[model samples]
Target: MMAFANFLFIVFLLPSLEALSNVNPSEYQQELNTQALILQACSNVENLSSCLSNFQGELQKSGPPTAQSIIHAALRATLDEASRAIDTITKFNSLSISYREQVAIEDCKELLDFSVSELAWSLMEMNRIRAGIKNVHYEGNLKAWLSAALSNPDTCLEGFEGTDRHLENFISGSIKQVTQLIGNVLGLYTQLHSLPFKPTRHDHNATTTKSSSDKFPEWMTEGDQGLLKGSSLGMHVDAIVALDGSGHYRTITEAINEAPSYSTRRYIIYVKTGVYRENIDMKRKKSYIMLVGDGIGKTVVTGNRNFMQGWTTFRTATVAVSGKGFIARDMTFRNTAGPLNHQAVALRVDSDQSAFYRCSMEGYQDTLYAHSLRQFYRECEIHGTIDYIFGNGAAVFQECKIYTRVPLPLQKVTITAQGRKSPHQSTGFSIQNSYIFASQPTYLGRPWKQYSRTVFMNTYMSALVQPRGWLEWYGNFALGTLWYGEYRNRGPGALLSGRVKWPGYHIIKDARTAKFFTVAQFIDGMSWLPSTGIKFTVGLGN
Candidate 1:
């Protein structure tokens, strides 16, 4: 019996001893080689050289620590080395090319891809070491200590098991950090690459450019060409319509139907200040269209189309955009259907690369349907009661105001319902530099399905945002894979002290880990988008 007790004690004590064992020399050597390869992949001369130096120093400093400690130290060193490499990449500049001209800057992009892949593989190996520790027997409450260390989502290693919350959180955080580093690296790459080797001199004899060009400001123009000027493009609208009181078009549909669809020139149907009571749909071939209104608050497009009306929640849209490259600025899309009538969408955007600027979208349920493809919304207002912003698309909401109208009596709900379907689709909503307000108490978001992913970054939230910011939509078992996180958020809603036990939502404490959702990573704004005069934020710090 005494021998058995000693055996048990030995078994228990082995894990702690193992924890102190020297890190595998082979693994350490492999990490060094991989780090060098990753740095070379970044292709930044200065960054690569600096990282190489740092990596050598770290390896030399690694001494007689246990295998677990050495592994931890190695992971930390790898992360630091990766960060330095990313910093170097961020300083790179992009090469400039004439409009419609193809540039050969794929080298940097390819290098970045390889680096990211290598980093991902390295992280996986680190996770394996972490997982192995769990199986190690420890002495004198070593399990408790191990549990505590692993409890910290950052250091805990993870495996492929679906129930491993620690691993999930760690990967989420790591991905976010790596993404940001990639962004910075890309930003620097663009800047450096775009620099002209030879500077051009100005000619004083050239004709002076007009002080007030007819072109619309570049900020207002879509990605196509120069902005449309009222003088050059003729009157923006052939006619003006107001629905509140005096106007030619009484209902919103009338104005839309009467508007010329096949104009050779770009035509904008400017709606004057008023709330139009009608559901609007833009059919196919409604090309080169632009909808401009007085303001989001003053110009409202609203309707009540619910599921009971034989309409799928997707079809019952107050305003549906089917035409490609459709643009709506300073307007409001609203569905009057209360929560009692579920699945009423205010706006369904089926068009590709559609953009909404300074607009407002409001509804009780399924308010904004970012249905398909990539969509961008900036400085807009979105309000809804339940699953308000739900869809499967690569949609980005930047510097927008999100409000949750008080849920009516008998209604218990959450706010955002991101319905991302797959990991490869690149379809999800990124809410950055935004504000979340709840008219009634609400949860920040809930998984609409398995693999549903949404990110909120540098946003402000009200107390109405529940401490458990995310809730499960029904009891979907697949939600274990859903990705949700909050970083550097302020207000009562930001408190993560008593968050739910689910492994999806992460309170990212490190700024390095919050980069995945930044402007650079989400849209590669650093390269092509900055020319638009839109300020693209870099890194995870606000």
Candidate 2:
């Protein structure tokens, strides 16, 4: 009986043990490769140890790792550690992989060229992060080891190559999936790190020469006096109060109430970073007053004023500026009332010669009311749904972004509903070299009055714009005198052949007539504006 038992053990149990012991050569090789890749990819000591510990456990459990499984495990483990760290590692892997995958996508051959450039850009970003990591101080020896690993070309390149292949193969199999993944993962990273990559004065000057329409001339020059003088001019005010460290007053209206009358020199108010929830009314004496904030997105002034809330369409404004020469920069004005309510104004600039630079005006309906005077917006973002940028003022939008959100039913209307009452007012809305985007289909312009005028010149119109660029307000017959025209507009929505036949729109067949709207003419930009650190074009030669 003992002999028989021993034979059974040898035949069954021994074979089972041996089968478990014998690791596949391919899997063993793959496991080793995966371990090396993970080690090289680790950004810090803690992450490195965590990755290595996970790998050891994985190896003990599986004996060996399949190439695909190992790669997947490594990525999953990295992502589990830290959100930012995982993003950095995945982006590093995606460059070459994205390129390979994009090339293999069916019917995407035409887009391959753009994909290559994008891949190169991702590589550059990875290189930059690697370089930045060296300067970061960590607690221990992990930093030294990570630095050494990054410097080792063979190990780094090997891991990079493997990840590249994985991405390429995955993307090739499902182009849309890979594209979406890359966009989500890398896009978030890019957005998080966007501040570092923003263009500075030096960068901008190196890229584009001084044109007549530039709003930042002082930053473009070699003289410190220009900057100091501009600052002094901007800082000049009737009354001043250092807010201690408070950064902001109790209310914007309080600050204005404390301000001296028009007889006093222009009042200057400097606000710090904080949410100011109050409606502001700038009377006539507030002329030449400047309101400066830390940043447009950071320093926010918000309210819930809409036409439906017992306030007139003109009175329901978070901020109503009636003072002339009112300049506001680096501040956000927002209205909480949504588009469904209609005519929710975040800002109503009724003052003449009022300018907004590097600011943000946000709301749903009638976000910005350029009610009267000459207004200029440079590098500003204006967001709304219906008639977001409107009024009787002669306003110029230069290098700005216009956003249109979806509106409720029966509220469908134009993005800009210009209300110029007469041509003698020298009032119109001119959008120049700007971007117009809509969350849903929208008309470019609509007549709000008898002689409403709006012009889009050298602008980018997104496909969300309706086929007919202009719409008559309430289907009014008086729109025959409304001037709605487009010159040198690019994008799918700027098809002029399909536009409405309005007498006010001049096809602009010649360059001479078009020159009237150039940067120089818009601001008479070459004279006083240049001293204020602005440069306008002399002619089309720019």
TM-score of each: 0.54, 0.55
TM-score, cand. 1: 0.54
Q: What overall lDDT goes with each candidate model?
A: 0.56, 0.56
Candidate 1 deviant stretches above 4 angstroms: 1-239, 243-266, 509-513, 524-541
RMSD to the hidden true structure, all candidates: 19.0, 26.3
Residue-pair clashes per prediction, in order, are 25, 6
Backbone clash pairs for candidate 2 read 212-535, 212-536, 212-537, 213-535, 213-536, 213-537
The weakest ten consecutive residues by lDDT in model 1 span 98-107
| Superposed model 2: Cα runs more than 4 Å off | 1-248, 263-267, 522-528, 531-542
Q: Give a tens-digit lDDT track for model 2, residues 358-432.
A: 789999888998766457777789898888887766677878888887778877757787765433334578887
